[model samples]
Target chain A: MARASLREDIVNAAVEQFHMFGFTAAGVKDITDAAGAPKGSFYNHFESKEALAVIALERYGATRGLAALGDTSVPPLARLRWHFEALRDENLAYGFSRGCLIGDLATEIADHSEVVRKAVQDSMQQWCDALSGTIAEAQQAGEVTKALEADTIARFVLSAWEGALVSARSDKSAKSFEAFFTVVFGVVLR
Target chain B: MARASLREDIVNAAVEQFHMFGFTAAGVKDITDAAGAPKGSFYNHFESKEALAVIALERYGATRGLAALGDTSVPPLARLRWHFEALRDENLAYGFSRGCLIGDLATEIADHSEVVRKAVQDSMQQWCDALSGTIAEAQQAGEVTKALEADTIARFVLSAWEGALVSARSDKSAKSFEAFFTVVFGVVLR
Candidate 1:
């Protein structure tokens, strides 16, 4: 494989492992083998497994979470709903066996590892920023209500969705995901 | 320590380790050392580290999580708020360095370990049950909306609080927790 393709392959493989098994429990050897890359090349591309894991989380959010939130044609609140629905679908796709890479890493990765921890923190902030912007627009249009500040509600909505994902993964059920949507739309915003 | 006290100490130590280091990364040796007990004594009390980890999770929930939800004097939603605020305070005590042990274990512990996963699942269900009862009462009192089912709302609130905890640990800030409370009470319950 070409150099660029090999690097991308390694990162993709690592992200899959981190999603399935957290950043800490997942072995680098398994990651490399999945990528079909040699062990020596993993070091050449990244400083450590933790570094690759961070990259994986950011990439996943950009492609999956942020992409849905950034869709402008959809109404702002609907876009927010879309973002969570996509996540719920993704979790179900995994048979509720795994969870968000960022949320999982924040809980599983060692706190002593500053770099990895910061990466997880930053990724979460990025989602809040994305959702917050849409929430601001929704508030202006009266779709989300003006009772609370856009930023605060945005953060709260993010927490509920993430928490719902936590329950989904732990219980291996879709009940938490469905219930989360009902409250957020049928009650909170309504 | 007496044999029973020694077992309690070991379990308490294991709980702390699981909170700090997660289920898979935390070692048996460290749990014993933290308990100031011998390694040999560990297996004598518990069949495996997995068994001990499950017990630790159950114990923590009884004292911290379920206890707050089970408080009868407080109104339903306020009791739920109390439960999350208590958790937020506990996280701040740790400098926002760790997260829920059950959440961490659900993502960290290997999926094939059915016993440990079931323990995490059941503990979550227990909280959902406790919250659902209070929610039904609140709905009857007109404190919460009649639009959503009490059981569904209960599950969503729990997920949101748990998800907020995830963010609190990730950002090392109380922002998510504060936002969670504001919207949950001000919007959903209102």
Candidate 2:
């Protein structure tokens, strides 16, 4: 493969492993093995494991945001639900063995590593911004109630969604995801 | 100090360092130094670092939950607010340098280590149960609305609180905590 494609492959593989096992636990060997790249190529592409994390986070953020945004054919509310549903399905497919990459990284490295922390933070903000913008559109379309501002609603939705993920990982069930959707979406649509 | 007291001190100190740093980043030396115990004594009290983490999590969970529960003089709603307020104060005091130990460990080890994952999950559930019971009491007393079920409300509250911590750590601001509380409490009360 080309150098750029090989580099991208490494990040994508690393992101998956990081989501499943966190940055520290998921080593360079695991990432390279998954990427189908030789060990030396990992070093050639990134300065170090931390550097790989930075790139992986950036790519993970962009891919997640784009995936959420690209489902444009669905209604705003359905699109929002779809975003979470996709996450839930993916989690279950993995046997609830994974959490959000950003959430995992934020918990693991936020206090200790400034570079990784910023990457995780920026990714979360981008997700929040995307959700907020969609909610704003829903507001304009009169699909959601006007009792709360979109930004505030966005924060609530995002935070609750993440909280539900934590619960899902712990409970080993997607029930938290379902309940979160039921309550928040129920309130929003009402 | 007696052996039991020394063990407690070691676990307490370990809790602080683990919360400020993380599992992999916080070393045995840090914990021993913080505890003012001999470095060699770490293995004496606990089988390994992982063993000590389980003890520390249990202690941290009990200490934090009891501290929150002991404030019976405050109204239930205010009691919940006080808990978050304390968290806000902690974040500010520590320069937004730490999130909850359980939260950090859940993210870091949930996928990789079943022992740590269960400890973190159990602690979170206990916290959620306590908060939920408090909210239910508040509803019965007409201190808060019954618009949503107490369990659902409690989950949302806890989740938002944890998510806010992550945001606060990332942004290096207590504003996220304040904003989250304002929005969540405002919504619940309304």
Candidates in order have lDDT scores of 0.81, 0.77
lDDT tens string, model 1, B1-190?
Answer: 3566889899999989988888777889899999999988888899999999889988877765676665778877787677777878888898887777777777676365888888989888888898888788778878887878888988998888888878888888889888987887777775
Query: How many clashes in each structure?
Result: 1, 0
Residue-by-residue lDDT tens digits, candidate 2, A1-190: 4566898788889988887777777889999999988987887878989888988888777656446653567778777777777777877897776777777787778777888888877887888788888787777778887777777777667766666777777757766766676667765444
Where model 1 places Cα greater than 4 Å from the true spot, the runs are A1-4, B1-4
TM-score computed on alpha carbons, candidate 1? 0.93
Chain B TM per candidate, please? 0.92, 0.88
Q: What's the residue-level lDDT of A189 in candidate 1? A: 68
Q: Estimate each model's TM-score.
A: 0.93, 0.90
Which candidate wins on lDDT?
1
Kindly report the interface RMSD of candidate 1, rounded to 1 decimal.
1.5
Worst 10 residues of 2 chain B by lDDT: B63-72
